[model samples]
Target chain A: MKKMMYISAVTEALAEEMERDESVFVIGEDVDIDGGVWNETAGLLERFGAKRVVGTPISEGAFTGLAAGAALTGLRPVVEFMYGDFIHVAMDQVANQIAKARLMFGGQAKMPVVIRLCACGAGTREGAQHSQFLESWFAHLPGFVVVAPSNAADGKGLMKSAIRSDLPVVFVESRQIYYDIQDVPEGEYTVPIGKAEILRPGEQVTLLSFGYACEKARQAAEMVKDKVDVEVIDLRTLKPLDTETIFKSVEKTGRLIVAHDSPAMCSIGAEVVRRVVAERFDYLDAPPVVVASKDVPIPFNDELEDYTVLSVQDIVDEIMKISVGII
Target chain B: MKKSSVASPSAEYFYRWMLAIRHSEQKLKELYIDHKIKGALHLSIGQEAVPVGVCAALSDGDKVFSTHRSHGHYIAKTHDIEGIMAELLGRATGCSNGYGGSMHLYNYEKGFLGGNGIVGGGISLALGAAFSAFYQNNGQIGVTFFGDGAANQGILHETLNLASLLKVPFLAVCENNGVAATTPVEKSTSETDRTKLAKAYKISSLSADGSDVEAVYAAASKAVAHLRAGKGPFLLNLRTCRWEPHCGIIKDTRDQKMLDDWRTNHDPLNVIAGRYPELLSSELRAEIGREVDARIEAAVAEAMTAPAPELAEYKRNFGV
Candidate 1:
């Protein structure tokens, strides 16, 4: 294993995938010469030339549609929406065209397209329009496998797996942890899409989360380790959700708290809580708690943004509350 | 009304195709009125020359993206009238296995990438297909067929700009039928001369008489050459006329005189039949018409008897 930044892990995955398969190409705004808006695709153009790495106009609809057509034709296209909020602009292509192509065509089409979205709200001063964690929209879409990688290792692994998959995948990466260093396996490896990783083994409370917020849950678990045995689960895949892992953890701990950066209503947390209540009601010691952002647009002010979204302290408090009753 | 003095392979086949499409639309109209076929239908009755001319220049490997009025485009590309009729009838053996009706006809094996219901939606998809052709280094090109109404969509301009910038092998064909559904181009768009819009993106553009099969074929030939030479994207504006309503069995409610004038003077079938009566003699026309009728009937019979798709298959594609 080698230590690397989350951004480096992303770039490394692109390079490795492009090298492994000639059909893989990257298309998005500022991806070619500009090396992506956040430099997540740096050195790709130099390594693969202009044919493999193409910079497109700011028209998300066109590029996203183009990526879909490219995927249908033969090439595996990894398209990037510079910001997660911009996914709204490309919704027609994503929801109407690409998402329905496989089923609408009677399974003749395998849409091997990966959409890399820089997602998550709070901590970024980019305000309401640019900062929004909208993975719920894609997770709800049919014919789409949504995955969010929290650390460098899963970031690289999930990206590789996403590129290789025969179905459409929305690989949601976080802007908040782009520079955070983590130990990633050197060379080639892939983490499966529909599986969750158990970050800590405990019996008192179960904390469930994905993406950059998963780090906060793990940290929160560590903070209350002396007083409570907290089990942290990183739900790497949102769709085809790793319900087996979630159910098993809930059964062991008998308490659950779901955390995410997106607003609480109609979010991933709601789905998790609903499923646990419906199927795993016998396993719960108390009603499942949810730690999520308030259902309000993220504010521009740093302090207001902090208040609007979840934090490590929020997860720690939720776990502590659940632990007191469970024990 | 200039006609091609010389009769070649395309001339003979073009006349037959125009006749086939015209007769097929007439059959569809009859079926809808008889309550045999259901759902929205966009007939390319008077605009057969545009697809025939454009597809004449395309190789078997080239991909074609289409709009809702896609029967002519699919027939022109694949020459599978039976399959198309079965698809329109929503059969188990249809191109999309009865899942896609009129607006969603796809035959990837024959290089017909199929049609989308949204206006101007196919443009970007076609551009992406062209990008794939370029990426694969397989010498394949992408073609998109949208009407004049679709030209006004913002995505069309965006696609045009990017196609020019990328220098990919693509052709964006605009079937300027002077109407977008019921709205005339003059009412919805400022620049009625739609080909001029390509100039803004610095892409090569051409204007063709869509009613004149010879003219459209000539323009398409030049476009194929331009694209083959790696000259980026080319926009072809085929100013044709739509004989039927934008959708359904409803006859056009537009100006009767204008429709009559076009049917008389600008109908591609009439133009070809009038220009070369000897080539399309009564006997020859009757034979082709019977062939098309038989094909459509066989397809309809098969489709009417074919069972609906299995629930398991539907669920699999639904990915639920």
Candidate 2:
């Protein structure tokens, strides 16, 4: 096992995939020389050369569409959106063109394109534009494979799987955990898409989350360990959701608390809770709770941003509330 | 202008392809009116020369990305009338297997990257294809066809700049069909000369009479040559007219006199046939017309009899 930062894991995965596949190429703003704003694609330009490591004009719609086109042909393109919020600028290309290409074309085309978004949330204090986790928006789309890995190991493994998949993937990497280090397995291995990882196993209640929020869920689980036994499941893949894992956990625990950095309304947490309620209604010991960011835009102010974002305490409170009789 | 005494076989082929598109569009219009074909239908009735001419200059390995008014482009590129007909009829045998109707038609083997419903959607897609060709050191180019409506979209300018900067083997063919649906080019953009947009990006461009198939072919050939020679991107503004409404068989709100003038003087088939009267003689014209009609009839028969896509197939595609 090799210890690496979450950002380095992403870069390593890209380098490894490019080395393995001749068709794999990197394209987007500041990706070539700049090595991406977060340096997630560092060393790719030198290794792959100018042809593969393409630095596009700051035209999100054009480059994103271009990546779709490249993917349509023989090339496998990994598009880096400097920030996840920039996806809105190229919404038509991302939501309509790339995502809908395969299904709309009757599966004749394989959209093996990976869109890497450096999704920053709350604590960054980059204001409403830069700090927003919009995974739910893409998760709602039909033809997208949404992945949000919390740590280095899963980051490397899942990215490899995403690049190798035939379908278009929205790979969301949180800037909050860019430097977070973890032991990634040596050499090649892929964390399969559409599977949830049980980070910590317990029996009292289930604490489900993804991306950076998984860190907070683990912390919350640790804090409430003595009082309430909590099972934490990091949903590595958001779309084609690992519902089987979630259902099994909810069925065991009989209580659930979904968490994420995105807004509570129309969030991944909402979907998780909705599914659990619809499927495992009889298993419920108490009403489920979704611990998520407020419905307002993430604030620029530090205090306001902290208030707007989901906190570890919030998860703890939800666990305590649901564990009323048990505790 | 230098004129040939006898039209070459290619010219004759262009003439036949243009006629096929014209007849197929007319058949589609009739089917739509009779409630045979449902959903949206955008026909390139008078603008057949643009696709036929541009496609004539492209090699077999080269790719073509087209806009919503794509019947002409699809028919010209693949000559798969039955595939397109079946697609519009939502049959399992359709080019896109009934998932894509009149707006979306794909044939990857033939290098037709399918038609996009969005106005300027295919511009950058073609650029990517060109980029791929350039990367692989393959002698292939990608040609994207858009109309006046899509010319104003930001993606077009963005793609032009990128294509020029990257020096990819890309061709942007703007079929300037006077008006974009109901909005005239004059009303949409102050600078109506679309070639200027390409020139601003330092990309070479040319303007051709879209009504004349030979003229379009000549200009497109120059553009394709420039692209194949690693001369970066080139844009061809084919000045043409839209005979039908933007979508469906609706009455055109344009000046009747203008439409009549275009139909009378600038009809692509008439312009080509008038130029090559001997090559497309009355006997040959009748024979070609009979052949085109028979093909259209066969395509319609196939589409009419083909089965609608099963729900299980749709479910499978949805997952895929």
What does chain B score (TM) in every candidate?
A: 0.94, 0.95
- Model 1, runs deviating above 4 Å: B1-8, B250-252, B316-319
- Residue A42, model 1, lDDT: 91
TM-score of the first chain of model 2: 0.98
Inter-residue clash pairs, candidate 2: none
Encode model 1's per-residue lDDT on A91-199: one tens digit a residue: 8789988888876776787799999897555677889898888789898887799999989999999999999999999988888899899899999989998999998
Real contacts recovered, all predictions: 0.70, 0.80
For candidate 2, lDDT tens digit of each residue in B229-316? 8889999998999888878967778888999999999998888788888988988988999999999999999899999989887776
Q: Per-prediction TM-score, please?
A: 0.96, 0.98
| lDDT per residue (tens digit) for residues B106-143 in model 1 | 89988888778888878889999889877876777889
Locate the minimum summed-lDDT window of 10 residues in model 2 chain A.
A117-126
Report residue A19 deviation for candidate 2 (angstroms). 0.5
Model 2, residue A67: distance off in Å is 0.3
